[model samples]
Target chain A: MTTQASVAPLDRAPAPETPFFFPSGDRPLYAVHHAPVAGRANAPVVVHCHSLGVEQVTCYRAEVLCARAAAAAGFPVLRYHARGHGDSAGDFADATLARLIEDALAAAREALRRSGATHVIWLGVRFGALVAASALPLGPPAAGLALWEPVQSPRDYFRAQLRGLLYSQVAEGRKPTETVDDLFARLDRDGAVDVHGYYLHRALADSVRDVTLARRLETWNGPTFLAQIEQRRSLAPAHAALAEALAARGAKVETMRVPEEPGWHMVANPAWTSPELVAATAEWLRAVA
Target chain B: MPWRESAADLDRARAERPIVVPSAFGGLVGIYTPAAPDVPSAGLCAVLLTRPRSHRNRMWVEGARRLAAQGFACFRFDYHGTGDSEGPTGPLDPNRPYRDDIVTVLRVLRAQLGGRRFVLCGACFDARTALSAFADEADAIAGLMFMAAPVVELDTLVRVDADRKDWGHLARSLRNPYNWKSLASAGRWRYMATVIGRVARRSLGAAPAGDPPLGAAFVEHFQALLRSRARALFLYGRDDAEYESFRIAERTAFAKLTPEQRARLEVEVWDGTVHGFLEMKRQRETFERALGWIAALHPARAAAPARTIPGDATPSAVAG
Candidate 1:
């Protein structure tokens, strides 16, 4: 079943939830394409890939809202889970670089087939950014890229995430019931590494460690934009350094600053959203990608 | 004092070749060092040590002192563009001759530390870049010591590779609800900002292009790094979630190494270390293991060529 996507044309209905089954003959990817109930066909496509962890569940509402906004803007938006999350087919343990890459390629193929649009605009949050960066380059390139807190270094990220978890839990007077090693070992044994209660698979974690999108971007040689927000300025030094490095290589960058709630990483607090960052990325993409 | 002992503290020491054996890569090799420039003689060695690896002010002699006291010279020198070296000072820009820096760092280490009996050591991702230097010349190194080497095979290592996703926007949105659309349009100077961001990524990206591996280290190379030499030591926190993220498979791989290969391998699991090995008392254990390594090498040192080994020679003169 070498199902390379060749989507059938359909009229864009207002607020339609288009059910899609994307198969690469390897794994079937389930997706729900969103469009305004009364939109015209050939609308701009927003391929929204979600984050990993409990946030994937918590922030799902926000993703829906973003998709709705894009749909209302005479643009069709689509969001899909990587093999293991939401209603996707495979187990999270199956999340590997190769599989995710295949899933991303299939998603892009389906996006092109459904929208009648030739180019795509990738909207990735967290791990999704890596997928889009890796997959988009395998084809005719994307129009633009909008990434939100894409995992920068899986090692540092997981470390920060774990430290954040410990701090928050400790602040709340939580005791270390089990050694952190046990938790990681449990994850490895079970194939799903748990981060702040979100169970992620071994393969997915491997994919994260293996996928280097900054290098991937260097290869893309197309319109690219990385929106970095300075909340507590935690990422300022690192991302700023990264920004400078990227700039020298020739990629559009938009940096935005906003107040941070210190414990955003500690606990998944959905209270902060930098409007400036969102605007900067949107505008950057409009101009470049 | 032959070299005007610049490191005021290491004025008294001597050089010793603790071990000389056939390198795993089919080459003859051994750890060598100079007698302490300042002290000149004192088998105690710790009080009279003098080899510094970085360009200058960026001296990484601390790792050696801390580890050597327990008994081995762990070379934590900074290569080009890092630490004290005048090479690449900017943000790991990736484009600025990193390979040259890699070559220079190793070449300098070889010139300075190889003849004096020193083991090559790396911390975190530094191991990856350092190993890449020897990827072609693995046979020349006396031995490799990776203190807290990242598990490049784990998925977490790839985060740096994802590029500048609008994390700021995500952070902003998570912090508060602010309409991001009209803002960029209203601001007349956005294009320049966008252009700058793009350029920075491109520049950083370019550095890693010729780099053997970018962002994350894979299982294959990581294993090679483990087996690159017969005397390879990997120290990491087994319990640290973040460290364990990628190390999960690597730890497993470490066990699969042969006994002879494994003899060359030492895996020290810090009960509770962050990615940086920030545990309270693990430093003591780490130092002890290093001392044990030095002791183990004593037998090998007896088998190597004997010279009128001056107890005063520091690591600098003998290493070269």
Candidate 2:
């Protein structure tokens, strides 16, 4: 007699991920929805908010893997490009912090409607985490927040970006004609500065310099998962401080120190996958679901 | 006039839609940007190949939009296992040209967009793939644009320590006292040693094993394409190593081409532009030059009306 397991396929194939466009204001935002395997009841959908500029391109594969893992674990996932980025309809110069937050809110609503879930989870990486947190107050209710190597301080982050611009300029064999102050001045005079290919608009630059995660998520009391991704075994000091602040606000915060290089910003092998990061995130999603 | 008037005009002119083409590996996701309604169509569709280690969003997105604005219907897609496409990503091998995916996309373009003539555009690894695919679909292709295409297979194996063209810049930096401080770091010392060791090994005739010379088949295919009715444009940055390799590796093959064949090909090297053309100034120049070249290919079709394809009427709109 054939056993039940032997007679049938060992596992059912996962549902195919879909690509579509949704309207955010007048422009369209591109998104890919990874459907969960059938037979789950009342699972929360996970909406991804991607990083800006080149980091978004570098972190793309890692995000895709994590989303698939979460979907396999019964969480419907939506990965999208914000306005002025990716396949989305807009120019980079048109993007602003306010516009990015608006797009995030739109994505959260779309995820809820598409998945037919009562609540959703915001999964953001780097600058995307800040966008999600800033949009928290003005959104449909979310069940949880999951961030991978979130940017705790926007001022420092933009400063580092400006430093990157300088590094690229040097690598191109150009003598440093402009200092950091000159770049700021250019942003003020021209209303934008070209960092690599993406133009950093004055409005977006000013907003990023003025905002921080602590200020944005001050009153948010909800379940949160923070992944501090680094090569070291210990959690970063900034991540530790952010976790403490969240816990003090009566939020159930679970922080994990992932001993892996931050593939989100580095030039790594194309086929590289962060297994530990995916497993930890899947476990967290299962617990929260 | 309002400052946003140009942007509004662009929005009104062009329309973008997402599409998925069924492939043997899986469904390949892509975005199609149609030519502006007001501008006359060139009756040509552009198929852009994806660069390795990066999705279509990096440079291809802007490149596609710019092409659309110039009255060419453009389609950019992810490979089977990349971007939003479905499949398990395999190891990164430069030699593994995704020729099957390119051919499949070309077939889908003919079916969905209703265009018989096409242009293939790619940079770096994708550029190499475009050349390989042109060998298979030369009859259907009208033009090709390759940015920094690597002609020598050995260039991928041997690591060139520094671009020889940047010697002036290096000497200038060495003369500066402030730049000398960087030499104090251990990392800088280690890098200097590595470069010296590599140079010494090369001088001693100690070449790396398994380094293959430029293949004769590759040269024959390129020469045949040049001999065809299709036009080709090659853009490269002066400082890029690929430019040097292409010059050295293809010198003999290029010399053998007939004058008429050479007339169909154009090669340009832009100053201060690196391999990726990261700066906006260089990128704009590249786009303008490419658009001009493609438009000159079929001047008679410039005033032709844009054809209405099935994609325009019924886009593959999946519920989200």
Candidate 3:
């Protein structure tokens, strides 16, 4: 048996990634910083806001790959878990959309401070894109925005999530005893509903339901990259409209439709990657930088 | 006692530290939650493994926190090529455990945590990995907590896939005369024929070729675990197909165990629980049961009382 006082030293050198906890109010948000590769400086630091629930798990690998790619291309990248998510301190049941936005802004500031960069770019995947966009007018000025399959309508997203809960119930061989309306009622009565292991809180549900990205995002005209990740070739109508709206407000908008699996929900491959998505985003980052 | 601390102090009690341990692939990213200082340390560390497709956050982050609160230092990490860990991702075989990555984590824990016996916990594919790791590092492991582990390797996956693809649809279709006609189509007929053939072979007391009895390796590892000093708790949802398969396959082996080995092993099948325990209610039940089992392992060292989840009755014990 080993003694409590004897600590063994690490045999290997430190990895390029640095994981730490930064404060978001009294609670701490977990974050990992990937330093820009050798001698690169003054490039806009990238702060990543991840999606909520299972989508976060599904897109985790892709997010890591994208962050590493950006870091290799001379941009310092910071990937963080919003409060009440991942290793962060808080219960998922208490997490609100507003709180998530606050966490994103905090991450952006921390990334800029750590990298000593003049500005920051927000990179968000799925619902995270909505968060990044939501934080735009509320924060430290962003140099650019990169959204991968952003959720344009929160109401539709919540409905889909509720449908997913029902689907899971049926998939587990249990006859779903409640309808979508009944679930909403339960959410109202209990203030939260379990949606495939994640707690969908009423506050979050209400806030998300009220958000219409195109109408709500009225300020800040920065360079933006919109990636429509799906099997089909065309940009989603809602996304195309959001891109047009951003352009209308003097933001330089570039949209790419990557023909790939929408990894935010269901993924067939565990090590799934979208090289095209990464490559295009990197190019966009370089251009904006 | 640490459990009597103020809300603020209790909130500050748990500190999640992120660590990167070097592996063959590169670095494996993990979060380590040390046992609360105010609590009596069990001198044991729990290593939580991630399911193949899911990240560590699935149900593990909260689990680690809960364990840490109960005086067990806990670590949960992403396997190389998954989550934030660096490596080239490739197709993973369900039968093949990620032994190398698991061993790497174990070594790091032994080095960093020091002087602590480890409890290996995992679910589904990861449960198999934990069992394999326990068999390989028996001396270092004090206990094993497995949820819905496959007694017969790859069998659960096959059943889950079949359930998703055919069983439900087939059962529903069989009730309708019109659907029976559609089921007689070439593709459907081929699938049904294969199933019937397998059933016929089983009835004739002939095992399928290439399908070893009770998964030879799993049985070997399990027997090794039983012979060791380490204790184990196996929890399964009654509805999970693996539950029935495990009960049928491991019956003889479990029956032949010595009283001492049986005393150290436990098996529980809960009512209305699914394979993943995806619902919060079921997850809480699992965590409470697991925590209770862990606490019972070393009662003198346990710092807090095992929390009882409401509405969870006594689980039906299949063994021990």
Candidate 4:
């Protein structure tokens, strides 16, 4: 047994990535700061916004992989659990798009201060990407933004989540006593509805559904990198359409379509990592830097 | 305790540094330790929260903090391969019967914080691991909390899954005739045929027996645990059918236990909740119940009791 008394209490070596909890409100947000190695002393720090619920659970390993790769490529990174998510304070049911944006802004400022980086770049995946876009105003003198398979519409995403919940209930031989309309009504009446295991509040649903990234992408004039993952041969039409729209807005956009299974959904396999995705991301950050 | 780091120091360091738990397996495992209590109390009790098989330590992070706020020391760690722990990725093996990781963590807690009375809490499959680990040293644990622990018969589980899927198919077809209409198409029929075949294979006689039944050993451990008079809490979701299957298995196992042994067990089922206590309100209630039980089992004259249970707030204190 490795007891504290038995093992020599040698101090841990200074790691490039320093983990800490930063203030948000009543509960502090859990965050990790990946300091750039010696060579990139003045590198731009990237703040990572994680995906929601099950996606966050499964893609954690991938997120770690991506952070390490980014750090190796000389980008100091700050990845945090937003309020009501991960190690952060507050209940998941109380989460709102506004609160998430506020939390992201706080994380970016903390990262910039701690890493001594001049600029903040928001790197987000899935719903996290949408948050990054919405939080753009909070991070001033933005270096760039990276969006990975960002959710096109919050309403559509929530609907899909509801379908999964229904399918599971049915698969388990129990009929979900509530329908989609019933859930919306419950959210309106009770201010919250339990979907799967997450508590979805009316305020959160209403605010998130109003978020349209296609309309907001032009607001971010900084260099942008958008990567989409696809299971089949061709890129998803929605992703292509997004890339075209960003380009039309006169934004410097670099789009890449990596053919691979969605890592966020594969929770069983913890070691699942998309080498191509990580490589493409690192390369894009290098080009932009 | 003079040789160990204080909780306040740990907290200060945590705010500025990454905290890693040293593993017996030659590498550091990632851990989220709640800030140690400001004033160290005598006979300080600590809780070690383990993951649900595939999940990392994040599931128990919030609960750990709640326990810490209540003046108990808490540690949430990723087992060797999962989370940020240093090890090759793979499922935790319950059969191998070795838990050097858990022992190492306990030893660290005892040595560092003077935490003598420890509570081992596990969710789902991890409950079995915690139980097995505590069985060897029953004298050490103050309590054991099992959340959605699976002690179900394999055949029962398979049947339940098939029945549920069948009901789902029927309900959908009834609700939307288009579902039945789609079955008229060749592709839909083939899909339906595949589903039927799969279900048939999983049935008791047709399916290949994979894992050996936990059988008498599962009950034996509990009996031994209760003989030692350690408190045990079984919290499951009322809506979970799989847990119902586990309850059936438990009934058979508990039939042999003495009433005295059964008296040590406490079970709580949250109505309208899912398997993992996914909703925040339910999670809070579950934590509150756990706090109440922990307080009652090892009541501290100095500490304040948790919030009162309004009517059904109290967990059913059933005799085994």
Error of 4 at A144 (Å): 2.8
Local error of candidate 4 at residue A152 (angstroms) = 2.3
Q: Kindly report the root-mean-square deviation of model 3 from the true structure over all alpha carbons.
A: 7.6
User: Model 1 chain B, poorest ten-residue lDDT window?
Assistant: B47-56
Better of 1 and 3 by TM-score: 3
* Decreasing lDDT order of the candidates: 3, 2, 4, 1
What is the alpha-carbon lDDT for the whole of candidate 4? 0.63
| lDDT measured at residue B85 in model 3 versus the true structure, 0 to 100 | 81
Give candidate 1 regions above 4 Å deviation. A1-19, A24-27, A36-44, A177-193, A233-235, A261-281, B1-320
Task: Give the poorly placed runs of model 3, Cα more than 4 Å off.
Answer: A1-15, A168-177, A259-272, B1-14, B51-58, B155-169, B173-212, B301-320
Question: Candidate 3 on B1-320: residue-level lDDT in tens?
Answer: 00112343225424777888889988888888888777777778888887322232345665566667767888888787777787767655535778888888889988886735889887777787788886568888898988886666554434432432334455664665544665758866766665555555655767535323466667767877876799888888766766655675446677688888878887777776646655667776676676676766554653645535346545566454
Output the number of the TM-score-best candidate: 3
Pairs in steric clash, model 3: none
> Fnat of each prediction?
0.00, 0.28, 0.35, 0.23
**Native-to-model Cα distance after best TM-score fit, residue A218 in candidate 3, in Å:** 2.0
Docking class of 3: acceptable
- Model 3: lDDT of residue A167: 66
lDDT by residue (A1-289, candidate 1, tens digit) is 0112222112122365554456654455556677544444544577876665444543343454455445544566777756655434444545576777677777877877787767788877766777777777784347666776666666566556665655544543456565556655665687654454344466666566654556666654444555543357445565566556666767655554444332332212222333344434444443452
Q: Report the poorest 10 consecutive residues by lDDT, candidate 4 chain B.
A: B1-10
| Residue-level lDDT tens digits of model 4 in A68-108 | 67776678888888876666656566678888888998898
**Whole-model lDDT values for every prediction:** 0.46, 0.70, 0.72, 0.63
Instruction: Give candidate 2's root-mean-square deviation (CA, Å).
Output: 8.7
Alpha carbon deviation, residue B215, candidate 4 (Å)? 6.8
Cα deviation at B304, candidate 1, in Å, is 78
lDDT of 3 by residue, A176-289 (tens): 899988988998898877776567778788878778777656775789888888877677789888888888889889888877755344533555567667777877887888
Give the native contact fraction of candidate 2. Answer: 0.28
B80-151: candidate 2 lDDT, tens digit per residue: 777677665764443556777888888898898887888988777677767777667888888888877666
